[model samples]
Target: MMAALRRRDFLFGSSLLLASPFFMRAARAASPRIISLDYGLAQTLIEFGTPPVGLIDTPGWYDWVMEPPLPPGIANVGSNYEINMEMLQLLQPDLIISTPYLEWIRPQLETIAPVKSFPIHAVGSSPYPHIIAATLELGQIVGQPQQAQALIDRTERDLLAAKAATRRLAEQKLAIMTFMDARNIRVYGPGGIFQDVLDRLELQNAWTRRTNEWGFSDAGLADLIGIGDSRIFYMDPVPADVLAGLAGSPLWQAMPFVQKGHAQRMASVLMFGALPSVSRFARLLAEVKV
Candidate 1:
């Protein structure tokens, strides 16, 4: 009976030698450390509230993904195809995630750590099922199955909400494009994530021209002139010089959508992203005044 010894009497030898909150947070960030090579895959991890320990091009994550802000203490492993080997070794990730697009280098990643490719777009089919499968699988990997289901449910709910919000917009023909300079544009069509979102929202995609499995075809302003009166939604952050060039091009000013005031500039949304991008595209379209 030490009479409940006075506080701080045994501070150095106390039974509670637990870690501080800051140290706990630091441990959380690195434990089960996962590295993502694809931004879309990274988006799923971020959604589950367990961002990767490292990823390709962390600096550009905000520039493209734009929401679900990236968490702190993640390392940048350099470009998608050109990962920094020394940095990769330093991070000591437990798992490295990639996509079919990076198949050529999966073996290289494997040399560093176990590499899991959440292949979604390789089969040249609808990305909806693949995204669902990937999300569920990744959820299991990160030990967040319940959160995964919640994410799926929320995405569907938000998509339906966007559908309701864009009831009138559904009646219009819409085409999404990203400029490859002022000369070439990648207009998205069938067989891609953007088209899947368009289909889900009960909207029409104006560019019926053939698209690669990734879902866009490189074309010029002259090619777009054929899709008369279709609402144009171009992804922004277009190179400044290219934007200036387009401004002066007579052809750009002459497109049917441009002449009819139907062209809209949308913030940069990853046309190739999975569920997260699907929801983002839906919201953007729903919010458009036109």
Candidate 2:
């Protein structure tokens, strides 16, 4: 009777061990090495503490995402739109995360492993909700749901704090731009994440022109006169030639923001990234001198 009781207890203990959280985590750690084809998704994966084994264009990460630098050992699998298939097979990833725009290459990626496409951009709506939903889904996929929630919570708090700290700029009527060339700039406005951040911060976006799906419009230097007394915050890494040309152009020097010293350049930040990008933008705004 004692021997039978001990055997029964042993079996129960074994079953509990198999179903334990540590066991589940170990099982996950051993399988499903992930590769991300989208930078935004890669950012999400890393933020949730489950970095992908590989991603696209690792070199450009410094110039764009800048914050949360890419961890070493992540393979650079070449271009985002078209990845190196042979290299991908060499990595032997169990899962590949991409965006809806890359559906064209899904069949190719599926040949190596299961491919999952997530979207943070919608044509006619703010992308903040979509970004949140994508982060949650990706966290669930990587078995880090709790970590993902923590990141979301932290981001919300940081953004709220940034908003309160930046209330002084509400009446400043800011125009965010990036130099496209000597005479042209891309002004950010409605339908873009920057605009969404501005809305959350209770600030105004001076660009009201028609924007593409990504939420920026191409305009000439003189066209900015329409914004009327708005401060211009341009992104950094402006091309050397564009700077030289602007310096020489009478029209560029004549801009109200330039003459008033309201045109300032900010550190590089990814305009197309996920939640981290939103938080980073807010933090940058809080640091704004205006």
Candidate 3:
């Protein structure tokens, strides 16, 4: 009887030991390896301390948005519009995230792993809420839902604080424009990213016309004169030489806003769709006197 009991006990112990890993695996959460195809999502992930293992287009030209550079060891999958399938497959990511604008590429990426695409610039959407929703969704997908909520809360608090700081000058009319290239300039009008920021501060946008798909309208220097006495905020980098050239231009010098000292050059904050970019804009607003 004692010998039989001993044998049964040993067998039971062996079985439990063999099943331990499976049980633990069932209870233990898995950390998903994600590939981020959107710059905004990538910025959110970095804030969450889980920088993507791979990214799409990361260029050095935009320093105001992704200052300090991407974390080392993160591979570039391809440009924003064109993702390299071969490299993406080799990375073996468990999930892929992208913007809704990139929906055409979803079918190809789905072959590798599950893909989630949200509209980065949804029509008639409030930028703040939309971005918070995106971040929360991303966190849930990556098994970090709590972290996402915390980040959203923090960002809102910061934004609110910034807005309050500028409330005294809320009536100031502000215009944000960027150079499309050397020859033409584009101004952020209704429904633009900067427009959202301006609305939050209750600042009037000098440009009231509808923008193109990219949220800007091409215009000559003369078009800016319509703002009358409003402040003009230029949102592109103007090198010293370019500034000198503009100073030399008769049309630029004769602009009513420039003559009245209402023309100001704002640092080129990344106007592209992203939270980090918006944060930069908020900071800039906080620093400006009017």
Task: Assess every candidate by TM-score.
Answer: 0.88, 0.88, 0.81
Clashes of 2: 0
Candidate 3 lDDT over residue span 1-290, tens digit each: 65454334333322322343322221232444678887778888887777888887666426445532478788889986678999898987766878777888788988887676767574554456677778877665544667778886776676787788877556667778876544467888655567777776667777877687556788876787787777887765764555667778887788878898888888777665566667668768878875
Worst 10 residues of 2 by lDDT: 13-22
In candidate 3, position 209 carries an lDDT of 71
lDDT of 1 by residue, 1-290 (tens): 23223222222222221242322222343235778888888888899998898989989987888766788888899997588978888987767888878889877777877677777874678888999998987776665667789889999998999989988887789999988887888998877888888898889999989888777888986899878998989897788887777667898898989989998889988776878888898899889996
Please report, as a residue range, the 10-residue window in candidate 1 with the lowest summed lDDT.
Answer: 6-15
lDDT of each: 0.79, 0.79, 0.69
Name the lDDT value of residue 287 in candidate 2.
94
TM-score of 1: 0.88
lDDT of 2: 0.79
Clashing pairs in 1: none
